[model samples]
Target: MTKKVLVIEDSMTSTKVLQKVIQKAGYTAVCASSLYQAKHLFDQSMPEEFLCAIVDFHLPDAPNGESIDFTIEAYIPTIVVTGREDEQTRSIIINKNIVDYFTKGNSQFYEYLSRLLGRLERNQQIGILVVEDSRAERNATVALLQRHNFITYAASNVADGLAQIGQQNNIKLVITDDDLPDMSGIKMVESLRQQHSKEDLAVIGIAYQGRPGLSASFIKSGANDYLTRPYCHEEFFCRVIQNVEYIENIDAIRRAANTDYLTGLPNRRYFFNRVNAILQSPPAHISLALLDIDYFKKINDSYGHDAGDAVLKGLAELLADICRDYQLARFGGEEFCIFMPLALSEACQQIETLRCRVEKLRIRFEKQILNCTISIGITDIYEGSIDDMLQYADKLLYQAKQQGRNQWISSDTKHRS
Candidate 1:
């Protein structure tokens, strides 16, 4: 199918160029020059027909971003293009989570736009792998996916197929036939189901010698979608497409849950989850640190909140550069935390190194320059649970603040068993 994209851009010349580019990229494109025209186009174009949309931040009708909101409410993935870099535009773009914002004059505008569309198109296809014993059945399944333009892979029976699965990354959907020499497909599906969440990996079973409603057993065996022998090719392909889409949606949501909005780090909830997991079967034992910026409150009060944000962002960059392997998070206002499994001593040393880099970080605002200092509280996990480790680190961090505001305090306290 030729992919359909509705472009709501005000510049007729730019829209014409975009139309040519999108068409050349093999998508059927529609261009609208204003909010009212966009509404008319949307009304005429059915939702199922258009794959997604691109919206301009300021249309002639709604100059302050009202039209983009309307488009997003329609459940289409929309990318925002804007001529203005105002605070209001940035806030709305962040709040609505529109896709991404691009200032039109940024020399890379055309490249970014092209990349966004490509990502959306690839996201639609969703990858699948089919495993069957019969050459004809396997080819039929592979043919069904290829006809739909879905990127696909196929393997014969249990052993060869599972080997393929381990080697292939992002193999979201799997179709397996139950009978095999190495192992039964039911057992394969069960093993995968036990190892991965239904949302992350979808398993569908196919059988050649089952009675009516036999697909129910496979569904019970943990397939997100089911199919039987003698199935219509169209129905089978549609089922495969639906499962792939479902798993991708689920993967997206899971990622969002694991991420933090402000500093773009893993949030505290996700941090604790890793800590708990480490305590269960921790290797060589890891170290945890409770790091806080000293005099942060004074900085927040002296400069505006925006500068304070700049400081936090600057520090986050520095930390990521120095301790790339360790997991870090903005623990709370003016405080952050890090956990490094194989490098507790090294993590402590790195945080101390970061403090020196952070102190030299001269943040410039409007006309003034500002410098900041950070203090770290470090503890290695040699005893106790994750909670106790945090408590130990927090206590040490409290001590670091006392021993003058810019020092790192590494305590010999044990906080996990």
Candidate 2:
């Protein structure tokens, strides 16, 4: 799949030049002579198409940058191309918060556009909550963020900042000035970090004056990084971008560790970790159940190992599908586990749904018919020991086998020991 570039230009020469540059740089080039044509192409193209866009200010449809402005409004990462390069013109361009800008040059705008495209390719969106008591400073930080292409929200103080943080789940970065009329920013960062879950997130403390080792204190108070007031734009952007990317990388890594490979479910390690969590309290009204296949070993032996593998996978799928509201896991070979946070009787109602679904699964392996059923051993939390619960369930499973397979034995009633 080639990365597609959408170039909206009215100039035939410049359009041809950009198309050639794009091809040379190894990206497929698409050209639109007017905004209508550009929109039409966008509507026709696949949703996943078009990595980035370059829009010319003046077009045949309407003059004075209509196409470029509309493209930016459409929420695509767009670079504005125009012959005007005066400070006033640049101010207007920057005010639109365009991702990048390309001025007409002898080298052609393709490489410059490609630089922004490169950034867009690796670019990750950073959610930044800017905390400022003064409206002036808040507007200043918001402008700075627009120049750097960061998604930002503004808050007046500690309370507002926390509220915005709660509202935006993607918030990876926070910038707060130290001298709020109420609640010093350093104290806010400390309090937030404690409640903010040590998961991937960054905080940078900003202050107008140097107040005796405040930077060190801020870092120690659970901020990832910090900056003094009256700083350069590049310095601020660098620190903010770095911290956001760091947290995002950590989040990606944690996800890989906890997710299961085969069925994309939470694997046994995570399941047991949760089980330990559920075991912290006495098993008063809580229940646990261990489900096993009726004749798993014989199914594999008679229908080849692949069929056995299919049964196990099919059972796991059915378990996950039916027990959508239950704590479930691929416990091990030929065995799966479910934990219901309710009394034995209520949990039985929930588990029976899964039992009936699996019992009806007629898994086909070539000509051989593979019908399956499962037996479950249920027990209460009863003083909160996983060891005791496992023993009780194991005893019930043995009982089910003795009484004949494909039957559920409730340890809460059938075997109290």
Candidate 3:
């Protein structure tokens, strides 16, 4: 689906440039030349239709940031652009909850605006925690974050802040004040570091001016960065966004390391690591399956590696869907593994279902449809280690391939027909 951006600039030149930037970023732009037009366009569009809004602070019809007010009121993430950059104007725009006001000082500033919009677009997927004892500061910080499309969790004290962080699975950044009612923010940051690593979570400590050594203490206590109170809006966003993006980049690297590039499935190393962990703390019952494409090499020889890749990708999709409730991974090449917490019979049924699906899948490549089949072997986790379970499953898989290819063999086949 194409994302839509709202542009409310009275100047045609700026409007055209901004719209081009938005479209270049693969988004559609809803252009409005005045405050009245912006409201009319917004009224016509759905509440969730606009990804975000770029509003001019001084619209012809509403010169005093009325357009900004309307966008914020409608809960649209907004970035304000204005010709003025005085402290009074900045303060007013900051208090109005604009993501970050931009000055039309130079062409480079607009380029920065485009990048900021891109960051704000991604901010929707990130969650941030604001920890401040003062109600006003907490609210203000949350407002700013929300304006940039961040999901925010607010805490008035250190304990609640930690609890909130623990509860959220996607929160990667935390902004906390140095003075908490119960404990020092430095101590809180130190405590959090014990549970969360810098790669997983980034913290920023906010201290008031004239507080000597506060920034130093916060950093020593494991904060990724520090900010002073009464900070500029631009500085605050820069620090927060940089830290969040750094953590996200680390996460992306980790995912690339653990994922299979061709099929986007977990790689052999990740699959084995998870299985080892499960073995360390055994569950009620664990089932392991090893699957290999029957005559996969023949496909590569007959059609070419490109077609073979298509078959692999198609089979990966089917297996992922079939084993949606279980742990499935592309171990390597035409091989896949499934770790299911199910009874022996149930696991066998699921594996057989997967085999049938593979048999029926017709993958299309360059105007030709190709057919494929997979043979699977299953074993139940009993008193053996993960390696033992894998070796047993692999043995059964060999049995299936030998018993004429495209079938499944379970370790406990004596009971079932």
TM-score per candidate? 0.64, 0.70, 0.90
lDDT of 1: 0.76
For model 2, residues 109-227, the per-residue Cα lDDT tens digits are 56656555655554436667899998998998887775445677999888889888888987878888888876998999888887774456688888556475888888888888888
Q: Residue by residue across 1-417, what tens digits does model 1's lDDT show?
A: 687888989888878877887877778888888888888988987776775677788887888888788777776666778888878777767566355567887888777567557756775556678888788988877765653445688887777777777887768888888767788787888878776778878888885544655577777778776776777544674577578768767877876888666677777888888777766877686888888888887888888898888788777777777767777877778888888775666666677678788888887776878788877778875676777878988888888788787877777544211
Instruction: Report backbone clashes per prediction.
Output: 6, 0, 0
**Model 1 alpha-carbon miss at residue 207, Å:** 5.5
**Cα lDDT of model 3 by residue, 220-278, tens digit:** 99999999888977788889889998998998998999999999888888888877887
C-alpha RMSD for every candidate: 13.8, 6.4, 2.6
RMSD of 2: 6.4
lDDT score at residue 63, model 1, on the 0-100 scale: 86
**How far off is residue 388 in model 2, in Å?**
2.4
Candidate 2 — which residues are off by over 4 angstroms? 1-36, 39-67, 79-96, 100-128, 139-153, 163-170, 207-214, 227-238, 294-318, 361-371, 381-383, 401-403, 413-417
Model 3, position 237, has a per-residue lDDT of 83
Which 10-residue span in candidate 3 carries the lowest summed lDDT? 408-417
